[model samples]
Target: MIDGVRAILIGDATLTGLVSTKIYPVSAPQKINPPLIVLIRKDADPNKCKTESGGVGRLDEIDFTVLIMSLSYGECETISERIRFLLDGFQGISNSKDLDIEYETEFDSYSEQAKLYVKNATYTAWYKT
Candidate 1:
């Protein structure tokens, strides 16, 4: 599920044109360039059972935190907006895996150590495994 979601986000032309292959799954590299995206799985819980069988389900409600980091605030905002536009309310098959994504705006801030602008977007992704 994580790999499928990462592939979908990384395959976006707008995002790739901006940051290329700088999309990290859990953590970014020690020395990362500006305008990168990091995907973190914040929390996950099993969805309500459909059948009477207790553990016979394949769906999960997963929350992901997408962090957009850039050198300037404007760039960060633009990238974050593009990511939201690309991912919000998206439902389809990615890499032959079934998934549904619903996103919400989280928060934005600035990092003093790296001198980077940061934007965090939270997504509720329902994945079938």
Candidate 2:
């Protein structure tokens, strides 16, 4: 079974002592996926979604109640704030519920359930449902 989460990378001196180094889901490195958002405004069907036409893409919306499971147990509110802080670090995050965490570990608790978004070589977060 997979363990909980710990902090990933610690921030710089300016950010040190402000965030934890406890990476959740085993406190190891994690690989990130791709970033893309698709909306079904005109002709959308979940049964026939495809990647070529942007039907299938990274997750852009968060229910705010889903399993954003953290390995280390911080207060939900605190973690939420930390995650919110990461959005800008991920790049191109504008009023979006998107954020991606990147590491280099092969095994992950959220494997196949998350993707990393990048713009101009910057990190962005979007997960899969």
Best by the TM-score measure: 1
Clashes of each: 0, 17
lDDT per residue for candidate 1 within 61-109, as digits (tens), equals 8999999999988988888888888788788998887788988668989
Candidate whose lDDT is highest: 1
lDDT (tens digit, per residue) of candidate 2 on 40-77 = 11121223224667676644422111123332324333
Error of 1 at 74 (Å): 0.8
My TM-score estimates for the predictions, one after another, are 0.90, 0.24
Query: Candidate 1 — what's its lDDT?
Result: 0.85
Off by over 4 Å in 2: 1-16, 26-48, 53-80, 88-129
What is the Å distance of residue 17 in model 2 from its true position? Answer: 3.7
